[model samples]
Target: MDWEEHAARLADEVTDRVSRWREPVAAVPRHELVPRWWQQVAGEWVLRDGPCDLEAWLAAAYCDTSLVTSIGALHADHALGDEKPTGLPTSSATLPSLVVRFLRHARLTQGLDLLDLGTGAGGLAAYAAQRLGSRHVTSVDVDPYLTDAAAGRLARMGLYPQFFAMDATRAIPGTYDRIIATVALEPGRGLVPVLRALRPGGRLVTTLANTSLILTAWKAENGGAVGQVERDWAGFMKTRHSTDYTPGPDALLAHARQAEGDEVTAGRYPVLDVSAAWELRSMLEVTTPGVELHYEENGRRRTACLVHTDGSWARATAEWLAPPEVHQGGPRRLWNELERIRNRLNAEGQLPLYGSRLEITPDGVCHLSRGKWTASLGV
Candidate 1:
């Protein structure tokens, strides 16, 4: 297979958006990094083996889209052809564009020591190692299998960078000049180890869990960092402590779908898929953390559900764009909070989440403010 040609074409495509990363994008062989991946087919995760179908492999590898390499605890590399695991994606080679965006946000420079957290398929680490000599780059991931696989793949391509298998939420090995986390970090305690590993005056770029907001901050003399919520948005899998994430709220969602709620009323607005609406999702996360949102459509009817650990649950059903029938149960009215956010959006035309000033203390607490709006995340 003419992988160099494919790589060159991919470089041409991505460099149009991130011109500075042209060389690294062209040099690294993304297909080699993600030899096997999982593709969801008809609501099932079907394995895709790159070597088995070169045409499909090249098409997917060179595209500006993420490729899932692991689902739940099953890595595509080890799955049988007949196996179709049902679980969340545990690892992936993030699209080339987002990796560039992260590096650009970090303001990378030669000779700077960099830490690449959440080294899923090692695409980001490979690109960074190629741009800045491998000696200056270190990649870390919680899954030892991922680190081992990525390290071997990178070495085969004549690129070598330090790799470590450790949970990023816990203690990291050493301090660095820059840290770029491709994983979504829980705003609270998860930020502690990462901040501790950042040298004074160093920069950090990452996304908060359950939100699409990108945070870019520079470490301060006071041990905290100060910057702003970037206007750009990106979502990543939250950092995991084990081989797979704890069971999701499937049982709670099933309950929300059928139970008679404490309150039921006609909603003012039509049912909206909160997960697909990035701005609204981020705002809702800021207003009420730990809310798991699920949306479904059957023929012309649509349903949106929200469940929280606090036992608050909301379900809305509607046809097309018609106003929804809303039901709420538990101490807090979850749907009301969502409508309040929507009303603010309709009234103000935009949200204060993007471009908000951000401050991170040594303990990992985040203070975000924009105009009269202010919110704190983390313990």
Candidate 2:
């Protein structure tokens, strides 16, 4: 089938997922946004030039999945033929369904001013410009090249939204009635600048870095925002601090794997895969930010590892459904803490992580409370 046919089918798929955003999904050409993307092939991040490979491009573009447009600062446009870029994804055209969900949460009206933060591939901004007039939309990104390219692409489709290449985490270019951030923001620091840029009583839809929490809140009279974590889960690339992707703590992972921990004990439950539990993972991230997790399943043996920047580490191993041996090191017993949180969940049947009450202060500190559990993000 042709590109138009693929686009139409993709629109139908997205509409099936979300009927409210049918028109925008049908109208916007997602292929234009992801003319070239990165795909993991053979354990390597290889560049896929869509224009050169129309069939492959059509298949990936129309599918409901993210297309990585940039690796580190290496935009797919600059990548050589067959080049395999390394590092975590810096930017991508988010999946169509997720984009529609965010737009739905924004509660856009006919002529409300909208700020599209993190215009990677400009898909969301293009859709918004199509739904609402381009005059009412503005798109911004940290990368100047991405902004310039997205503006050009949007113009080709008659979308002329104002495009700015600036840090969305810092002072924005203008105030808006609504702001949708595709870029994941650091937990506490996300709210302040977004609230500052939002007009009084305006709404903001965004996600926190290192967690899958789609947060929606409205600007309040006190320069803060009040919101609740949506029941839905979503993830996006974290806001970058440098031109290249910042390397994670690989050095620590090595040590955490081999070093004899300060404390060792038998886990109350079988080795658990924390990543498989959304509520548990999100809650742990809120309470202990920047903790990295790894889990492996080998035959009947299940092993889990947790590493934190504070020199804390935990390892658990056991057979399926059997009590596991846990080793914890450093100042905090990471595994023990996880077990405590897990025990609470097993008893209460849920963690106070999703749909929890969130109160953000003017300085961007967020206090989350649900039932008897409370945690501060900016601490």
Candidate 3:
């Protein structure tokens, strides 16, 4: 079939995934949303625009997957195909599958007041407003241009909502019965404003950054929200107030490519695909901020560093390195904890990470439960 046929099929699928009221919104052409996006080619991020060929553009737009918008998290708008290894992906219209899953989790109802945080491309907002009524929906993002562009797309579709360009960390204007965040929340106190904006008996759905933790909370009678980790998956881009997320493979990849190490050793243990381990990854990111893992040499050697703004450093180098020497200077033994967690997973064949329970008290100190090992949320 042609792009139009595929778009119709995709629209039907998305409508069924969201709600009946969203059919028209989903039917709006996908090519319209992603008229132009950035893709990494030969390790360089370049702007790729369509609407030239209907078929090619439709294939990219209607498919239930994410298109890379910015590489290295920097604006790919002016990238001259000079930046290497791309950059950490800054933004994109998240895959349709993930969007569907989140909308289902959100459970939008007709005439319900909704708030879409991080209105990337405004697809989800379009989907939400189609069912919930455009007047009842509000979308906010920190990027003014992003919001403006999404607003323009919505206008083309004849779907209108109050699109505001503002930081989510501050007090939003109105109360919302449902708030869905597509951007990950900052470590602590950043989500308090989100919670504050929710009206009583409201629904809050969002995903933690860089991890698989998908959280859903509902406003209770007494002004607090309580909910557990959803038994599914979702991920959001890390929230950014600056130009881009700082310090990642961009800085260290070059260092590793020409490092003066003794030898490239074979790894002792099987490498774990960290994406499959959501809770453990979330806990690790919070407990050891700025920790990035690097695997090299036929996937044998692993060097992970935990860097802090205080200049304290902890480095762990494991290979078929025999003893797996762990260097340390910070107050905390970051590598030791990782090894412990690794051992825990090994001992039980799996950690009690997933399928655990979450309880959010009124003050937002999330208490996580896993058998007998209870832990605080904010680390």
Name the lDDT value of residue 209 in candidate 1: 92
Q: Summarize candidate 1's per-residue lDDT along 1-379 as a digit string, tens digits.
A: 6888889898888776556689899998899998899998888999999999999999999999999999999999999999989878989999998998899999999899999999999999999999898999999999999999999999998989999999889889999999999999998789999999999989999999989999999999988899999999998999989889998888878999998899999999999889889999999988999999999999889999999988999999999899999989988999999999999999999999999999998888899999999998885
Candidate 1 local Cα displacement, residue 240, angstroms: 1.0
Give the CA lDDT, 0 to 100, for residue 1 in model 1. Answer: 69
Q: Which is the winner by lDDT between candidate 1 and candidate 2?
A: 1
Local distance difference test, per candidate? 0.93, 0.84, 0.67
- Rank candidates, lDDT, best first: 1, 2, 3
Q: Name the candidate that leads on TM-score.
A: 1
Best lDDT among the predictions, by candidate number: 1
Tens-place lDDT per residue, model 3, 1-379, is 2455776677666556545644654456667778777765654556765655666777788887787655554444444445443446666787776776787788777768999998877878887766667898899987776788888988887889889988787667789989998888753466778878899989988766656677788887766677777777666787777436666544443443345333333333444434445655666764565455544333576555444444344444655444555455535555455666777767888765456677665555566677897765544
Q: Rank the candidates by TM-score, best first.
A: 1, 2, 3
Residue 222 CA displacement from its true place in model 3, Å: 4.2
Each candidate structure's TM-score, on Cα atoms with residue i matched to residue i, is: 0.98, 0.92, 0.83
Clashes of each: 1, 0, 6
Candidate 2 lDDT score at position 378: 62
Clashing residue pairs, backbone N/CA/C < 3 A, model 3: 71-87, 72-87, 72-88, 73-88, 73-90, 266-320
